[model samples]
Every structure is written in structure tokens, then in C-alpha cells.
Target: MKQNKLIGLGVATMAAFLLLSVNTAEAARTDMVDVSNHNGYMNVSDWTGMRDKYGVKSMVTKISEGTFYKDYTAANNIATAKQAGIYQNGYHFARYKTAAQAESEANYAATLAKQDGLPNNAVLVTDVEAAEQQYTPLTTNDYNNFIFMSTVQKYGYRTDIYTSGSWMNNIMTVKPGTGWIASYPYVVGDKQWYTGNHAWQFSSTQNFAGTTAVGNFDVSQLNDDFYTGGQNTKPVNPVTPPVTNNNQVANQDYAQTGTFTANTTVNVRSGVANNAPIVATYAPGQSLNYNHIYIVNGVVKGRYTSYSGQTRYASMGYIPGGSFGKRSAVSNSRTYTVRYGDSFWSIANRLGINMNSLAAKNGKTINSIIYPNQQLMY
Candidate 1:
């Protein structure tokens, strides 16, 4: 009976060890890629090749930089990654060192993310690795919390942090968050990275196996909570393409009528596609009266009939350089004193008012020349 009892105890111990090993293997980190305009345009095949060949399970796209720049390739990246069955999120290149600046940047990044179709549940990360932060450092996590809460309260997306190990160790007063931490060991195999982090960017020059991509890429190991629980739950304001027969879209998704004024010269395309022929162009402050608009394939489009009786589309939202224009709206009553080199068109465009209304209120015509300091009501 003593020998039988000894055998039973040994079997029980062996079974417990096997179960522990299996659980560890199951919790092993999955790989991911974070891309920006530097990576150029990734097509469906590029994403698929990364997924199928190198075990890339998710992607983090750079959506905006600071407050002025928007990553033009972000929309395309999100769309193609979704096609390749890769979960998608976004990160903003943070330039904020104060709470106010942090709030502004959060709004800019969140707006761009929504415009680019980043899902509501996907993590919106603030990249805090800029050198400027070192010189003028943020003393507290409160500034970052401003960014985090802005996305949560206003945009309905949670936030994350990405920073170098040096910053995490020496610079930051408080640890940023339980997000992706970057530190290159310059070694091989799955290595442990920062403590209490969901993901670790182990290498910035990882050459994935069998990838046709030319240069080295930034790769991360995600244990959990890196892919929004492995799903993008809510797609924000998705724009479906209109019904088309032979590339000619017949109807828009909705009928939206408004006047869009170009803040800069932007192309009026023949169709909703980016490669469509340029039918016309809007000069700075020139207004286009559009009957309807469509958000197709991540581009906001407006339809107008040209003089030749053909329908033309104008992009009213974000493009490579900037937004084509904005909706023309004047919210307050104001007066303006004309300055040097100011014309009716120039003043109207600058003030976002109607040129005709400006001239009529000032008892002048568009062709009338007025001297500087002339008071005008708008």
C-alpha cells in the first residue's frame, strides 16, 4: 500500500507541471508592427505577407504628428490592414509638454483618427519619445491624463503610451501607462522587456522571415490588451461606397448640402477615386456650392455639375497636404478694418463670410477699390 501511494503522488505532481507549461505557452507574446508614412503605402499583400509569413497579428498606424501634420497614408493603412485580417489601432506623435497643449493635441489626434476610420474601441496611443520633451519635460502624468481622458470622454476610445526605456527610467517622473514599452536588446528570440507592460517593442530593425519588405521594421511583442482584446469593436462613421456600374458612382450614401470654401487650392476630381481625372480646382478662399457629398473609401467627396453638364467631385476633407476646405459658417457678428493688400475676396475668405454680403454691408462693389483702414461690417 505504501508503494501505491508513492506512485499516485508522483503522477499528480507530473500532471500539475504539464498544465503549468501549457498555460505559459498559451500566454506567449504575439508579434505586431507599428507603421507610419516612413513605411510608405502598405497594400493588402504587404499586410498579408507580414501576417502569414512573420506572424504579425496587429498594427499600430501613425495618425497625426503634433498639431499641424496628418499622416496621409494612415487611411489606406487601416483599410488594407483590415482587409488582411490584422487588428488596427493608431498613435499620435505627441508634442505636448503642458496640460493645455496636451488637450489640444488630443483633440487633433482624435479628430484625425475618426476621419481616418480608426475604430472606437481600438487604442489611441500618444508617442512621447520626442527630444523636445527632454529639454522641456512634463513634470507629471496629469498632462498625459489630459490626452487620455479627452479621447475617452469626447471620442470614446481608450489611450495608451509608447516611449523608449531611457525615458521610462530616467526622464518620466511617473511611468506613462501599462502600454507598449520599447527597448532594443539587439538579441534574438522572445525576450522579456519592461515590467507590468502589455506590449514591448523589442526591435526597431527586425527583419521578419520571408518578408519582401526591403528595410528593417519596428516590431513588438503583445501579451494582451494590445489589439483591443483582439478585435476592433466599433467602426466610427464608416462611409460606404455608392452603388456603381463601371466605376461611375450613381448615388451618394446621404444627401448633404453645404458650401465648402477652399482654404487652399485643391483638386476637383471626376470621381471619388484618388486617381480620378482633375476636372477643376479651387483656389484659396474660392467657394464651391455642392449639392451633395459622400464619404467613400475614406475620402469625403462633394458633387457639383460642371458647365459642360458633367458631375464633378470635390474632396472637402483631408488629403495628403491638408484638408481641402471646411464648411463655411460665420458664428458671430464682427467688424473688420481693411489692411494693406486686402480685397473683398481676400477679406471674405479670411473672415469666412460672403464676399457679396461684405460688399453690400460696406456700400461697395467687389470691383471697388478701398483704401487701408476702411471699416467694414460683416
Candidate 2:
């Protein structure tokens, strides 16, 4: 009897140990590494070393800005990182000027990425910071942010917003397509800032797998799927190519329409009427790429060429014609200004206004034009 009892206890102990081992293995499998470029610069060799040594999976390289940090080393870093088989993402340090300015920067960045042939794993991120001295606040910062983020999404690129925890929760109320949180913990048991972020930058300098520098990181491979998730979820919307003779319209399916509020010099093309591509570099809030049609004297201006390339124009006649049309009779009426990571739908929902009414009030459709600093009445 005694021998039998001892045998039973031994069996129970073995079973518990086996179950614990299984649980441990499952937890280890879920661990991942994500890294970003927050410091002024990153050594390509150092980045490569981190990846190899600590299994670093994803990276966000800083690009350009309207501030003193003019040029973005991201393009060069991305090229180098790709050669070594690491996934790369491009991010802009947003110097929030106006909704229109932010949109232009986003559009310009997208154009750059398109020109550069961004990697299959590439994503676009907006880094919102107000540390610089020459910053102006917008009334509808949250609304404008929605426009900027949505515009990036329209370009077939994944989008995310990177900001400090307090800024994310307080100053900006817009929900990003995804979030990259930066919160430095002073104590070991501090609560994390971003609960739904795909990637978290826990500390500035963490020695992981025998490497050091502001290199502490984590990558959620699961988040990669989330970043690109919309590609599968949303049905592809087809765009009608404007009828033009001089230049052949290759693919209008990917064309995006937005008001340009900036006045940077853009390329103005020579041939093609109505939809002629006028590549004009712009200032902060000049309207651009109006659905391959530009309105002059209430008529469609064909195609034009710019320095960047060919762009289609959309005539103002297509925009609700006149402002006098019956203002949308939706339940709520409000206007929102632009911010770093906003979208049209997001703005409408936050203000408790019907999205259709908001779009109609703006003299556009669901995906119509709303530039930075411009007011959209519902």
C-alpha cells in the first residue's frame, strides 16, 4: 500500500512539470524585437550587428522634416538594411505647421517612396513632436491628423503614429492606423504607455544579447501582420482614368485626390489639356492631384507634367459646384482642423457627426478633399 501511494505522488509531480515546460516554451516563442531610429543618426554597421546578434526584426528609420533636420538618412539606411535582409520602415518627424503642411509632407514622402521602390515590408510612420520652437497649434489638430494618416493609407502604404505616451493621450485624440509608443520607465514596475501598439520602445539604451547604445527594443511579428492587415481587409477601389490624348494613363486605380494648401514649387507640365500634369513644387497648403482633372474657368484642364512626374487634375466644378448648395442636414454640425495623424471618418466620429453629412458639408464624397487648416463643416 505504501509503495503504491508513493508511485501515485511521483506520477502527479511528473505531470505538473511537463505542463509547466510546455507553457514556458509557448511564452518564449512569442518574444520578438523591434527597433527604431530616434537618435540623430544610426551607424549602418551597428544596426546590422544588432539584428544579427539579438534577432532584431523590424526597424523604423527617420526620414526628412520641415525643421532643421532637413534630410532623412532613412533612404540610405533602408537600402543598406534591405541588403542585409532586415525589414525596413520609413518615418517622418512631423513638424506640425498646419493640416495642409502635414498632408504635403506625407504626400511628398509617399512620392519619394514610390520613386525609390519601397521594400515589400516597408511602412510609413509619422513622428509627432512639438519640441521645436517655431510651432503653431491648429484648432482641429486631431481632424487634420486623420486626413494625413488616411492620405498615406490611400497610397497603398501601411501607416502608424509615433508619439510620447502623454502626448498621445492628451494633446492628440486621433486614433492612428497603428501606434509606436515611446515611454521611458524610471522604475522597474512602471506601467506601459501603449497597450495596443504594435511596437514599443521601452528604454533608450538596453543591452540585449551583448549589444548596447539606445538599442533596447522589441518586435511583434504579430504586429507586422496587423500593419499590413488592411491590404486584405479593404476591397480595392477602382479610379476612373480621365480621358486624355497626349499622355497615356497607365493606372488611375492608385490615384489619390486632396486639396493642396501649401505653395512649394511644383512641376507644371507642358502637353495635355484639362488633365495636364502641372508638376508645381508647392508651399504649405496648395491643392494638388485633383483626381487627374484641374478646373480653370469651370472647365476640366487636361493632363500636365511636373518635375516629379505626371499628375492628373480634378476640376473644382466637380467639388459641390458652389458653397450655396443645401448644407448637409445631418444630426450634428461641426468643423475640424488638421493634425499629424487624422482621417476624415475619424474626425466625423469624434465630433458625433454623421460621416456622410460631414463629407457632403465639405463639398466632397467620403474620400474627397480636406487639406490641413481647412475647415470641414458638418
Backbone clash total, candidate 1 = 0
Q: Candidate 1, overall lDDT?
A: 0.63
Q: Residue-wise lDDT of candidate 1 within 27-142, one digit each (tens)?
A: 12336788888888888877765664345678899998778989998999999988988888888887777777778888899999999999878888877766556655455554
> Each model's TM-score, in the order given?
0.51, 0.43
**Highest-scoring model, lDDT:** 1
* Runs off by more than 4 Å, candidate 1: 1-30, 173-177, 231-378
lDDT of each: 0.63, 0.45
**Candidate 1 at 354: error in angstroms?**
96
Clashes of each: 0, 66
The top-ranked prediction according to TM-score is 1
Q: Give the TM-score of candidate 1.
A: 0.51
